[model samples]
Target: MQFKWNYEPPTPERQKAAKELGEKIGMSPILANLLIQRGIKTESAAKRFFRPMLNELIDPFLMNDMDVAVDRLNDAMGRKERIMIYGDYDVDGCTAVALVYKFLQQFYSNIEYYIPDRYDEGYGVSRKGIDYAKETGVKLIIILDCGIKAIDEIAYAKSLDIDFIICDHHVPDEEMPPAVAILNPKRPDSTYPFHHLSGCGVGFKFMQAFAKNNGIPFARLIPLLDLCAVSIASDIVPVTGENRTLAFHGLKQLNQSPSVGLKAIIDICGLTNRELTMSDIVFKIGPRINASGRMQNGKEAVELLVEKDFRRALVEAGMINEYNEQRKDVDKQMTEEANSIVEKLESQKHLSSIVLYDENWKKGVIGIVASRLTEIYFRPTIVLTMSDGMATGSARSVAGFDIYDAIKSCRDLLENFGGHTYAAGLSLKAENIKEFICRFQAYVNNHIMPEQTQPILDIEEVIDFKDITKKMQADLKKFAPHGPCNPKPLFCTRNVYDYGTSKVVGRHQEHIKLELVDSRSSNVMNGIAFGQSAAARYIKSKRSFDIVYTIEENAYKRGEVQLQIEDIMPDTQKKNEK
Candidate 1:
């Protein structure tokens, strides 16, 4: 739990130039320093980070199968064929289904959606789902968020005379499934400029190509941003560049101006038709949308997201809220169990990765356990739910490791696997699970660093009391909507004081909220550190420590312009270290 600050001091000239340019641009010296550290020295490069435009988005046709996928969807509509928009059950998957279903609905009346049951059928495109596609007499199946790993299933659908167009963002196998059109940037033949589109982003581009071909104004489709942005945030994709543009516009689209379905969710969160921010969506709305699949069926989220009636939307939101509540309960228990297992395992000996499976673990929440373990262990973690002679669940990894590719390396043992770098889903036979873990360990051992085996908070710079300003906050907002690749700036200030004489907060008293001030200068700021109530003891003693926090517009007071703390490290930043 300890991190050493290896501050990479800026060259004197570089610091001088950054400070001078920051003054010219009305930016804080701290922000200018952080920008320079991010290699964003040029005005043009920096400007694009903040004010990204839809025009900057790459052409939809740049994708390898965009034209073919568009043509096939159009063909299905022209022929009046029954088409099923297939998708996964997560926020990304469900929203992709919603995005594609809505786009096709404008032209094709036969468009319906099918999402697999998380417990019974598990993640990705399911054979049962495909069978449903076949039984519905679906002439065409356009898969969103899934199908990249469905080599066998896609072939089976093809055998049934059902054509498929896959819009996915998961890493591909050496040999792809024989779908009619494969629209994943990771595909070898793909020319898409960016390879890291969220599943919904890929689905969005598929719709864009369809729009361009069918003479449909994609402008009409802009409303889908609320859907896409929620997915982008929940799925944890980088919000830099194109993704940022989507989320920026999408967050804007969500404020009081949401669709009837989203309005219901907003109301359920006790914010009645008010302006919403990324925080509102991520902390409040996105969790409710994701809870359905994590605890029950992810398709419920899609139903709520696309509903047009306020009454129905409320019903859906209420259902989601209830599910999210139960999900948190289950998640809390599973996280504790996973943490205990990790503690027991690590106490015996060190390992490059953490892999655990249990027959009794709930399939719906195994991914949650994996994510939690990764946060605690700060390494690659996989949690599997064993049932029916097979284990299924999720993998979450750290920065330097690619969990999907690591799983792919042991594909012989896995019946199927799919996902991106940091997150993935898979199913492996119970007997092969042991061998799979060994190989997975080897895979990670070769790629990871000795240092990365332990979690390290990479601090860019430590700011003094005189380093922050409102303009710095605005400058950092330019790189938004920051996510996976471009993250919100993490600033650290050493030896800070609180104005409100801090107190433990949150439902569990596991958090600390206070107004921080420089004891000498009277420069005041506010912060909240979740799960850091232990630090309150230090605050009570008037201890000045290195604190790492992201600037947040605290909505705790309904409408406060004060900054909130994200994470704190009382001992992380030392004077001699700086």
Candidate 2:
């Protein structure tokens, strides 16, 4: 349970530049330095960063094949062809399906949505789904969130006379699918301005192009931003560029006037009284939506999402909430069992990656288990379970590691695999599990940086207690909808001592609620250190310590700031070292 504090003090030249820029922009140098690190050097860029406007979003047509995708959709609608909306079962996929289905359903009635059963059909463009489309006389399918690697499946659908328009954001293989038009910013030939977008984000852009082509007012598209924001947050995509604008406005929509389905979920989560943030979606909202997919069928999630009646949506949300409870129970059990297995590994300390296989493990929850193992072990980890006589599983990676590539390196052993840099899904013959593990582990060991296998707290800046002002707090608040690339800034305060009122809090006394002061000022800052009560004795000894933390609004006291301390260590230790 140790963390490496990562902070490099600004050089004098950079400090001078930051100060000059701060003066030019009428802001603090620390805030300016943070902006500069994010590549916002000029005042206008900083202005745009803080207040990203909707009109500034990149033109949807700039994406490769966007015109073709739009034209195909227009042709389908004009001919009144039976259209089927399809997506994966996860939050991003469900949201994509819901966004496209809800938007198109307003003007068209010949459309239906499909979410393949995770257990029955597995992931991506399943053969069963294509057969269903064929059976139902559907002529076109708009598959979202997953389809980049579905070459064979798309061809199968094509043979069935069903054309496909794929809207995905995953890294694609060299050979593309035989869809009518594939819309992915990561495509090799893509000229899209932004490279990172969630699956739902891609679907939103497709709808945007469709709206523009049909002369539909842009205001009509605003309501769907809530789904886009949920997907962006849940999928952990970068919250910069076009994503920032979408998430920013999406959050406004979520807080001010959420869709009926989301409103039902909000009320169920007891968040109806407060403004929802990205964190709320990640921790509270997204999981509930995903639970339906994990515990049962994801169709329930899409049904709830696109439901028009509040009463019906509320009923659906209640069922989904029950599923979430079930998911939590299974996840806890699986994570504990996986940890025990890892603890028993003979080469636990020397191993660079983890590959655990248990046929009895639930396939739906292995992804969560893999994530937990990666966070705890600080290594690329894969958790596999038996599915359809194959060892199928989910892979999660440490920071700065590419898990998808690691799995791709063992593609010969894998029957199918696809994902992003940090997360992926793969399946291999049960007999190949042993070989896959050895190769995957060796690849990780050879490529992963030594420091990448350790937990690190990346401090954005070092600032004194006195520098935390109302204006600085407000400026930080403007950096909303924070995620992967544009994260909530983490600040380091060196040599700060606990005030007399600092004491253990929490039901089990596992946290420290702090009243702290620094040597430079008498300003006592309130902070909370979760799961750090082990440091309470030293803190009470009046010993100063360095703390790395992110500033957050005090939940109990609105408008007041609280330091959510991430890591704490004695001040005498070597600074900023692993």
Candidate 3:
């Protein structure tokens, strides 16, 4: 894939401020510069960034309708009313349901949890779920990770004498759902200081409010942070401000004393001794948890999460792992089929978007397939499959593209759609699929710039090999629990040569293993570029090159830092100059 390297240049004033702050704090200027670039310009800001505390979380009551939600919950508990916790099927929703249901189970026994089947019930606030609540004599229903736009569904439930308290983080419509209480930070009337809480984060805030109102110490809720962290990471929310604080502490909990289900999963993945990071959850744990819902039932995931017995949790985790294996098989086959279709479409190669459809494609893996297609085609892509009588699928956008808005432009054809800017889900009449595709392509062609179709390597700074010292590596560790907003810093080094012993490694010989030496100081560093064996030709040519990479402690060798290469290009300009 081709990439555009966009190097960030800190202004002179900002550089001077960072240097002064570094001197005041007795740290490296480069570390200070990185902090300032992330909006931490003062000693106080830097301290908070480095040491995020649980107390720093915003007051839960500050969220709009939080008080009402707490009051409804208190009433339910006092009356011993039957209440159902309803949630979506993804990781965020499953975790949210688990966290709230477990926390409430301590003080109440009339509660039950419900997760709508992805294929049968589709997305949020399903008619089947509402009917279940109504038939079971449930008086209150708490919706998590969804229901923000469930106006009609909420009204239908209300007619059946079932009140609702909604906890969600997705963008809301102009007219809010007529629920008893709606808690969302993105609501226009919200007074909450943070606006980027995941669906599980919103659910966590509600739990906090319930605990505080009942005179329970906030420490009692600390154990639930592991679930919150998993949700935040899997949901792909920005890791800044409150999220960073939550993830920072949550990871500590996950490493030190994970819940029974999480520990079982860790054992299954053979990560018992390793310290867990956000990346681990995103790849290993998150997918396994989500697989249960995708392949069979989300209730299995919730059951595993709230299970208190280690042996029982292990059994559940094993079943979920098998589901994950099934998910992987389906995902791989779907991706291969999608690739074959893309390859045969020679005429559609030059278009600004990719929209492919198949009646036999598994609806569960279309989202994952859409994401993988972007890596090969590198554009706004959508993968559609026949679900029910309609065409349903997922859309994945390249960086900086608003795929949700693009889908909204063709809403005339779509029966329903909802999601964030980078990703979304939609469905349309099966017959309208052709028209929707043409309109979607036209929308992309008109609005998407030519450069937006290509991938981008955002380099934070250009640095010398000598500057990558032990102290620098230590300073960088403070920026842990990295994600969307506060990402691991990427640095570019120009005019570097392969240190003669470099070669392609990995079982398939698809990884580049090299020792890079600086042109000026001749300082040497080991680098690994995973799946970049294509660059072997450039390395074998022995040409000076520029490489972009992030620094990481090499686990194979203690007390050593290595470069995890992001991109590499031959330094043709420098070669010409020589």
Candidate 4:
């Protein structure tokens, strides 16, 4: 896929500030500029950004309804009331359920977790789940990740004498549910300092409040940051402010001493030796946890997460691994079919958005397919499939688009819908599929920016080979747990030529392994351009080309840094000069 390289050089004033800050901090100006771009203008802010502290976390009681939620929770445990920890079936939801259930189960005995079946109960607070709670004598249900929209279900649970304390992070409507307390940073009246916590993060805060109220040591909560890190990375939330602190510590916990379940998964993924990063969770561990929900029951994921026995957890992790493999197969097939359908669309090129429907498509993997389509076509996309006599599917948006609003615009046609700015889920009558498609596309057309329709590679900074030093790479490590708000820096280095050893090296010969040297320095840097073998001929011709990439430590050579090239283009500046 072609990309538009987006690099807005900092203004003179900002550059001066960055220079001054760099000199003050004894680092390169480029590193300081990246910090400034992320709104870290002062030394204190940069220090906090680099060295996130647990003590710096916001007071949990500062959140709206915290007092009520904590009081209700404490009362339930005080009376030994049977409490149910319920959650959605996604990663954020499963991790939230596991985290809460694990923590509370330590001190409270009358607690169990519930994950509604993706097929039988669908997403969020199902009537069946409420009935189960009623039958099981559950007096309080702490629903996580997805209760903000379950007004009717919460009422039903209430009628059965069950109270709800909801911990969610999704955008909420003005008319809130009838829960005993709702803890969501995105609530209309929320004054929580950080608004971007993951659903699990919200759950964590609830637990934090509970711990603080009970005078429990904060050290006990540190173990659960592994789950928070997973949810924060998997849910694709912004990693700034509170999130950064949680994820940074969570990653440390994961690498040093993970919970038994995550340790099992880490071993299964063959990543037990190396230090795990947020990227590892997003790519490896998160998928395995999510696969259980997609292919089977999400409860299995929670069960494994809260399991104490390593042997049992390993067996569960192995099963989850199989589920992940199955999910991948189904996801790949659905994505290919979706791509074929999109290719056949008569108005494919001109349309501002994409909505594809097929009754035969697997509902389990439609979200993955929709995400694949958005990445491939670079447009807001929704892939729907027939489920429970209704057309149900997931929607994915481009970098800056609010897909939730676009889906909300077609709510009349949709039987149910809820999600965030870049992703959502919806179901509608089969007959309304065509109208929903037209309406959703129209809304996107009316609101989407022209640039949002295209794939754009944001180049964070421009640097020469000389700037790619050991010190810079080490300092870059300070930017751990990168995500939405604080993304891994992307660098562009221009006019670099291959040093005679670039060659195709992938299993299908689809990648270029390069030994590169720029004119500014004689240092030969090792780089890998994945799936860019088509550019091998030009690169081999000794023609200088410009590249945009991220630097990472070479897995093969532990101490060496390698450029993971994103894109390579001919040297336009040098073309006229030569």
Candidate 5:
């Protein structure tokens, strides 16, 4: 797929200021430029960004209802109340439950955890989960990663004499649940400094407050950060502010001294010798952790996360690995089937959205399929399957589109729907599927701009090949743990010629390996464009091109930096336009 490169230029004043700051800090100009681009303009901001200290974390009591949540937990613990840690089935939820449950276990043994089965209890707070709490004689329930929208469920639990402390991070509806304390920063009345925390991050903050109130030093809770980091990475939350600090420290803990379960997973994935990055967790650890809930019971994932013995954790990790393999196979097959359905649609070219449904589709993998479909269709996409006699589905949207709003427009047909701007989940009567698809397409067609449908490569700046250097790469390393809002910088180098050594190099020759030389400086650099073998033809024709890429150290060749090409376009400005 081709992308429109959107160049972002820094102001001259800002550039000069950053350069001066870099000189003061004894760093390179490129590093300074990148830092300034990320809003780290001053020496103090640079120090905070590069060396995130745990003490820099905001006080947990500042969050809305945080003190009340802590008081409620203390009350439960003092009375020896049976407290249940309730969470959703995904990684964020499971990790949240594990983090809180394990922390509580350190002082109290009366606490237990409950992860509702995805197949039986769709998502969030459910009657089955509440009923389980009642059966276990639980007096207090700590709801994590969910329950912000469970007004009715919370009411029902309250009726059963159960109190709830919600720690969700999703966008909440206007009518909040009557929990003892709601710890979601997204709450309109919330005063938390950072609002983009993951579900587990909120749970971590709750524990932080609890530790402080109980006279337990906050430093003692640092070991729980690995779980928080996994949740942040897996949940796709913005890695900025407190989230960055948590993820940074959490990743260090994960690399240096991970929990037994995380260590087992790292070993099983053959990553024991290497440091794991956010991408590694997202692709390697996250999926395996999620596969348990997607393919089987989420309780297994929580169990693995809470396991204390390395030997037992390995056994559990092995079982989870098998589930992951099964998940992959199901996901691949369903995606292919969804693609074929899109191909067979006669109006596919004119349609503003892609909506497909299959009765046989496993609900577990439909979300993955919806995301995969968007890569091919590049529009608001929904993949639905029959679940409990209802048409249940997951919706994925383009970059600028509000999929939740579009889905909301069809609320008349939906029994329930909730999520954020880019992704959402919904279920409706089987007969409403056709109407929902038609109305959804109409809404997107009217609201989505033409350019919004096309993929966009957000280039941070345009730079010469000579600007790429070992010092620049070293300085960029300080920008550890990059994600939304603070993404790795993408630079576009224009009018670069690929040396004759350029060749297609991957197992299927699907990647282009090129030695590029800047037209202005004659500086050479190695560039690799994965899944871009088509670009080899342009290289073979000796065409000058503009390439958007991120600089990375080529680990295989020690001490060598290379360009990881994001997109390539022919040098069009040099040619006369029509």
Candidate 6:
């Protein structure tokens, strides 16, 4: 609710580069401005961002010792040695495991898959997983989305003659895991150009390398894009560089043609043989896949993605639906509990942050809760679930705050942890919870400016009624498949006439629909606000306020275009001014 509205312009060189690229790409002024704002100034950078080419992707062998990894994997295939895939328990991890297993199955049938129990073995390659691979006569183990910190587990696997090739994106510790080949881009000495691929993306690169080496034609890789695209969009990785190429093309596969498993799930989501959008994946598709892992065992989710038969996919769909219900219930309860914590903390003058630890809390939903709490409170927050004398939790933070560095400040109290700047996971002794809480708070206080720690909507421009047009939507779409580094453009409009009443329209008033019109030509755009029933009052009161939003296909019955309201403010000057 209290955003600082931080807006800073790009450097002159970056702007110049963006202008040149914009001229070359034939982008609109608005889209070009957005591009310039995001640091894509050069012709090459814009080409990569807008029209990502599969050929431009770095050679998988360019990754440190990737040649060794490929050689080891080929050796496993040649010797017919059993291989095991160890991955994290989240959707990204599940998807990574599924992708790797699917690709490796092409070369050899002796491949096995293993996902660590969120409660039992925790994140990354674990001794429990390694032992099972060993028991099953596995000679090669590949770690996906995890294993950057599995020094001990990697050592244990080595002792059992289980070689490991880690394909993870998490930050590695000072001392790396002694795997057969480590494929982490975060490695300081690594020369890989891009550093933002999700775990699934990295795993896809491995498949890409294998495919290219085998000369297994390009069309073979298309089927896998649906899974990779879903993972890329769902995991919230920055959509730039090689990630741009993967997600842009992957989204096409999801909409055009997907695997049987994906097709089944898409049908279940009431979308099949139809054009799909990021909204479809993020809201309709991804949550269901995530539900299988969060509410039920992650194995079910993996099975749903890997299943071939339509009948079996249907069965998997039913199981996924059931798990989604349970996941929703858990997410709702955890969100309420987290809200209560925020209320209590604020009531006690302890700030609006939420830091609660419960031994009984489910490990699977902590990250989801952390995400929800951060969005609700718009503050740096932490959610911890304790178990067996230890507390494992996730942290989500606002902009201008580095959660990883903050966690690092209190690392002495943590047994282990690693993640990116905005989100991280940690495990610590139960006794250290208080120390961590205090130390983390101290770190936050020392770093973040009072005004800088809020959910500020940086606006692209303030436009009048005449400037917003139907053609604008088509032009804006050049920046399609937008994500992190390349964000959907945010615009502000004011002095619009609200034609009186608002309705709670969608299937139980699940959303708010208010009729608003541009001053000129009476070009009415139905402003639909999802999950915002309270916003009707603002429109009904003849509130002449500033509205910040994106133009989206609020396709009513199919053809009507509308403005999707993201934020409503009291005045235009207040919104535009600092």
Residue pairs whose backbone atoms clash in candidate 2: none
Compared with the true structure, what per-residue lDDT tens digits does model 6 show for residues 204-264?
Answer: 8888877778788766777787778888788888877788788888888787778778888
How high is the lDDT of residue 109 in model 5? 96
lDDT of 2 at 13: 85
Clashing pairs in 5: none
RMSD of each: 2.7, 1.4, 1.7, 1.5, 1.7, 2.9
Better structure of 4 and 6 per lDDT: 4
Which has the higher lDDT value, candidate number 4 or candidate number 5? 4
TM-score for each predicted model, relative to the true structure: 0.92, 0.98, 0.97, 0.98, 0.96, 0.92
Q: Distance from true position, residue 365, model 2, in Å?
A: 0.5
Report the Cα lDDT for candidate 1.
0.79
- Model 4 Cα lDDT, one tens digit per residue, 514-562: 9999999999999999999989998998989999999999987987999
Q: In candidate 1, residue 557 scores what lDDT?
A: 55
Q: Residue by residue across 1-578, what tens digits does model 1's lDDT show? A: 55544456678988897887677666766676766777777667666655667877889998997888888877788888999988888888988998888777876688788888877887676789888888888999888888887888888888889998998887787888899999998887778888878889988888877777778786977988888888888888877657888898888888747888888888899976555666667788878888888788888888887787899889889999999999889889988987787777743256688898878887778888888888877889899888566888689998777788888889889887778888888888888988998999888888888776666556666675555655555566665666666666666676777665678999999988787876446677777777778778878777676677667655655433354555565644454445
Candidate 3: the clashing residue pairs are none
Better TM-score candidate (2, 5)? 2
Q: Residue 32's C-alpha lDDT in candidate 3?
A: 89
The true-versus-predicted C-alpha distance at residue 112 of model 6, in Å, is 1.1
Model 5, which residues run further than 4 Å from truth?
A: 521-523, 572-578
Q: List candidate 4 stretches off by more than 4 Å.
A: 572-578
True lDDT of residue 116, candidate 4: 97
For model 2, residues 321-406, the per-residue Cα lDDT tens digits are: 99999999999999999999998988867989999999999999999999999988888999999999988999999889999899
lDDT of 3 by residue, 1-578 (tens): 76778876888987898889999777888888888889888898889889999987899999999999999999988998999999989999999999999898988999999999988988899888999999999999999999988899999999999999999988777789999999999898879999999898999999999999999889888999999899989998999988998899889999999999899999988788887889899999999999988899999999999999999999999999999999999999999999998889996887999999999998888999999998888899999999888899899998778998899999889888888888889999998999999999999999998778888888888889999999899889889998998889999998889889899999999999989898878688999999999988888788888999999988778779999998888876446546
lDDT per residue for candidate 5 within 265-377, as digits (tens), equals 99999887886899889999999999999999899999999999999999999999999999999999999988898998989789789999899999988988999999887
